[model samples]
Target: MPDGVASVTLEYPKKISRGRYFKPAVFPSAFIKTVQVHDNVLSVAIPRGAPDAFPHRMVWRDAAGAVVHAFTDPAF
Candidate 1:
């Protein structure tokens, strides 16, 4: 679990066992129903396989779906 959001850290097999990060991402919100993995990021989806809406910003949500404060997207 992340400091405040509902996140899971997965360990991959290193070098050939590592991962690359993709930004411009989204997750399930009040308007969305599902969270899915797409490419290297999380994609927010609607119920029953409907089209997805673009989210301007997103961070990890707590187990209760409350947004996390510490997991803000780095302003790099």
Candidate 2:
């Protein structure tokens, strides 16, 4: 993020169904801090002890709070 703003959302398994056993659970959402750099890779910093997140797109808005860019890859 150019303006130093970023976020992340994670979703865990709701339940597991195998054979004759089922475990139900819900995982809370986690947010990551946006690391900004004038030049370099743009990545979000996840909280400590966090697992890899699921595939998702990032929605970027301008300082005026208007949608500027949205994509899965910054190179886009």
Q: How many clashes show up in model 2?
A: 0
Can you write out model 1's per-residue Cα lDDT over 1-76, one digit (the tens) per residue?
Answer: 3344454222211112112564332334333233533333554433322222322234455567655542222331
Ten-residue region with minimum lDDT total, candidate 2? 8-17
Tens-place lDDT per residue, model 2, 3-74, is 533332222232212224644333355343443333424555443334234323455554444555655632
Whole-model alpha-carbon lDDT for candidate 1: 0.34
Clashes of each: 4, 0
Query: Which candidate tops TM-score?
Result: 2
Evaluate all candidate structures by whole-model CA lDDT and list the values in order: 0.34, 0.40
Top-lDDT candidate index: 2
To one decimal, what is the Cα RMSD in angstroms of model 1 from the true structure?
13.2
Per-residue lDDT, model 1, residue 70, is 28
How many Å off is the CA of 49 in candidate 2?
Answer: 6.4
